[model samples]
Target: MSDEKNDKDRRGIQSVEVGGQLLRALAHHGHPMALKDLARAAGMAPAKAHPYLVSFGKLGLIEQDPASGRYGLGPLALQLGLIALQQTDPVRIATPMIAELAQRLGLTIGIAVWGTRGPTFVRLEESPAAIHVNMRHGTVASLTDTASGRLFGAYRPADEVRALFEQERLLGKLERPRLAPGTPAAPAPTSWKEFERALAEVRRHGMSRTEGAVVDGISAMSAPVFDHAGAMVLAVTAIGPSGALDTQWDGPVAQALRECADRITQRLGGRPPVPVRRAA
Candidate 1:
């Protein structure tokens, strides 16, 4: 059996491995690269890398910008990544980490994934103290009123995020009259400008937080988890009564949440998006 395994390992192609290394280098850099740089990173000569890139471009695994002569992952690569993400259970992978976080912090932890209705809580680990907030598995968090939702809003595609905000607006209107006559309306972003500003902050810091926005006296912080293709797959959130779970982005709870999300992202072979720099 050992010899058969060794035979199988030794039976493969070298050129294919070299081509895959180029793809891996492009993926690791997470940006388009000039031919020379890409070849250097892959430890190959530009002359040698060009043919493989041409083949990959024909197959839709890579694309070269005509203007800049830079190479990046192509649409087919994105499609393959989405398909691969579908096969993995993000919630299952996040469960143990969330459980450990809950136990250590004495705060409820939840994993929310992008569902048809937006960011939906798929799993929850309750804190030892019975904190009474209405979150449960399958609860569709309000995109404009919760940390988990805003985390998704900040990281998800713009079209999807806009749709979620529109849906939330309609729902809010429908549910407004149900509130007690004098109850104060929830404070939410009132304009696209405000919403974009909030999302910008989330993007800059790689997390989001809310204080009493979803549930009175409740606080929550959430960080995004990415897949191998740099797509957001889920979010890890920490929630508790306001006094227990600090809502500040730099607090211990927020740091732990971000670290847990980062760990999950790394485990899934994902890279965070590279920040763009403007002219000085």
Candidate 2:
């Protein structure tokens, strides 16, 4: 497994490259990054990290501050990221799919994962036409107000869903998905009856279908991906401004979307788990 991983890393980018990249982030930001901070930034485990980074510092690719014991780039690491963006391929594979979906659906299509926080957008591809909708990739997504957010919140474990608010930056609102700017926001459903009603629609339908939740004139539907380990690693959805989507939930597109979601689940390696917990 390690050999295969090493080969894959070599094809794309190396951990040494990532460690060096992480070091530079600390240096540019001008701070002492904790071990966990570096690990999170590099998508690595702390137990397996320090030594690889220390080796870079030893080579002067990065330097560790004595007072903080944090690593920073020593010049070599900076030179590398400056030269890197030329080789990333995950985006390459994901982009074509997003573009195709957007073109066909006349909506913005995106793939996002359940990061430690919320749905962290991994890639976003837009249609090439003159008029279209789009969202930035690599940004955090929402858990409220947007079509995809409803799907995410519905599928997410009741425990981890709380993490979205742990930082309290949102003031009980969805952060990444800015519910439409002018549309009247749903007054916080004061009762579980209201909240669970919303979730029930999303889960049973597979794709989160909504109207006027984000913008007064938009509609959206999203499907959660069942992952290899039977975990929902991500969800993909297509959303568009008001007129683009209509009462089409029972139409061909909607059926295709359901199949797509299930196919994505199979591709990821599991079926969405049968509902386990009873209503409290």
Mind giving the per-residue lDDT tens digits that candidate 1 earns over 27-50?
889999999999999999999999
Global Cα lDDT for candidate 1: 0.83
Q: Cα lDDT of model 2 overall?
A: 0.63
lDDT of 1 at 37: 96
Model 1 alpha-carbon miss at residue 71, Å: 19
lDDT tens digits by residue: candidate 2, 1-280: 9999998877955665766656656654666677788777766788777887778777777677788877666776556645552333333434555566677776667777777657777776564543333357766655666666667778777656544534323465444444435545443434445555778787777667777664556667777776434556566777666565554778755765666667555433356666856253
CA lDDT scores, all candidates in order:
0.83, 0.63
- What is the Cα-based TM-score of model 2? 0.57
Candidate 2 all-Cα RMSD: 14.4
The residue ranges of model 1 lying beyond 4 angstroms of the native Cα positions read: 1-87, 173-185, 274-280
Every model's TM-score: 0.66, 0.57
